[model samples]
Target: MSHPPAPPTSPHPRRWLTSRARVGLVLAVPLLGLVNQFLGFFVLVLAIVLIWKDNPWEKAAKVVATIAATALLGAVVPDPQGKDAGGTVARADGKGTAHGRAVDAVTSASPSPSPTVKPGPRAADYRGLRLDRAREKAEAAGFGVGDHNASDDGKSIWMRSNWTVCFQKTGWTWSDTKTIDFGAVQTGAPCPEEDGGAVPWPKMPDLVWKTWKTARKEVVDLGVPADHVLADTAYVNDTLPDEGDYDDWRVCVTDPSADSDVTLDAWVTLGLTDPRNGCPKSDREDGDRPSLPDRDDDGDPDYHDPFPGDRNRDSAFPNGLPRGSDGSGGSSGDDDWDWNCPHTRWC
Candidate 1:
């Protein structure tokens, strides 16, 4: 008599493959000269085989097999490192993590080549557009420009972005230099219609003031030491009738100590609605000359400082000036304005 239908058995012949069989299947992929895609397929098959047994031990084994397969896939994939649209993560510290490191490598390697930043309008293109002229443009816009430095080799220029109109030096051997940016004039603004092609700051309140405050803080917090910084204002402008009513600040920095020709950091502000009250020009020291006369007679200078909060005691002149003495209802250079009032010219 024929055996009773041979006892119902598993449909898959290899459903209970031994551990060695599973390992061999995975290792055999590379040896068989199969491409990574094929190996990936095998990995899935192996996992299925191991798990089909319905044993806890088998399930654990399948998971391990899958992990091994994924590791190999990383090697074959063109860019296994996952990256964001910007090609990098927003945070720099993330690079220390495994995933972050991978993402950074992939992004840096392909790097869209930095979009070949096109050269902007040259300072010379504007003809009489020297640093002072640019400074004037910033002031007229209601912004300010702080001291800046040039590259040691003169190939690149960088400055604090605290002011609007600023310059930067760029290039390696052939050394090309160019004016990089104008201060924040307004938020979401296109190039000013009057300036022909100068980028305009957006007039939006949210973006203009908020961004300005952020940039100013960055300058104060990150600026290189003066002993390490060769500072100068290549351009300063207080009047730009064509541009909308906004202040712009610009600056440059050169790190000679590091033997680098490129400006390291720059700061600037744009679209200042109100003039920053400076240490009131001291009349106590110069009451004799009408030219020295405080225009507002508030004991403060008529011109507003691009950066208003003073930290140096020296800038505060004619000691004993009271706080809120400024005609604008703020302290003039007198109150806390001691010989140490950091804003004082002689301090």
Candidate 2:
């Protein structure tokens, strides 16, 4: 046995490992370079170490190097939109100068200017001018006439040329829509009539004995303006009643007698009384005897008696028909001495 130690077994495993390491290094360096330059450099150094130091830990070191290279390559590659690894846009010129980079940044950051707007039509003042002139001025200023109205109550003068503008809707200012209205009156006509030239003068309507509601409607039907008709209500107890709750009240008297003529703007006042106040005292009722106040013994009341305080004419006639009697509506006459006389003693 001592004559010759068995020839040392050839190191087949070590030789196999060295050959494998050389082949791995050759393949890894070029493959990694295709992925990333920096990753390829790092992998090259790692491959050299793997080849020179063939030890028990070599397998693990090779594995770790391969994984690290793969990860680094993935991080270094550009994105699909040509952005760098850090997500910044890459310049196509590839110039590294500071001025070039600043110019690129400014161009991207600047916003485009907005489009200019054209101006619109302007407004103008048209107060206190004649209607025709006002219309002309308005049209000249790019406006249109909207409405025409009377400034006061009167007949609406259909002729615009004969109208005087007292008020304008837009006043002195111009409007965007370029339209205006004129409250006008007929030329040479009253500028501010009581009825604003809206209604014509009408005969006073017969509202007596009509309810307040009916009276108001008659007034309106007669073309009398609502403001021209005034209402005065008296309750049964002589207390003022609410004007709003006068539907049940009766019309007692009117300011102007029925069938009287009145101006268009005249105030036709209605005197209303509660139904509980009984019939209104009027000469038309009961032959004017009950309504009249005759302090003396005359047959006629003071209003009709010619000789109101004279006993000689106390019961001679009705309403002092014989005009020659004194203030008392009485005179001696066989025909006048009727059984239906107000003064029975004289009859």
- Model 1 bad stretches (over 4 Å): 1-24, 29-34, 37-112, 121-124, 127-347
Question: So what's the TM-score on candidate 1?
Answer: 0.20
Residue-wise C-alpha lDDT for candidate 2, range 1-347, written one tens digit per residue: 46866887776887778767755664667577777777777776776566547544467765775566456455555434322323234355546633223222213444567896545344565655778888888877766675456644435557788777766654233434645666776554344453245423356777767888888888777656788788874322233357677776788778776877565445778877666555456655444312335656554445445567755454445343333433344444544544335444344
lDDT tens digits, residues 50-147, model 1?
Answer: 54455435567667766765565545545434444334343345555433322333433554556676654323222123444566654454333332
Q: Name the TM-score of candidate 2.
A: 0.27
Instruction: TM-score each candidate.
Output: 0.20, 0.27
**lDDT, each prediction:** 0.37, 0.59
Candidate 2: where is the Cα deviation over 4 Å? 1-200, 234-237, 284-347
Candidate 2 lowest-lDDT run of ten: 98-107
Say which candidate scores most in lDDT.
Answer: 2
Considering summed lDDT, which 10 consecutive residues are worst modelled in model 1? 253-262
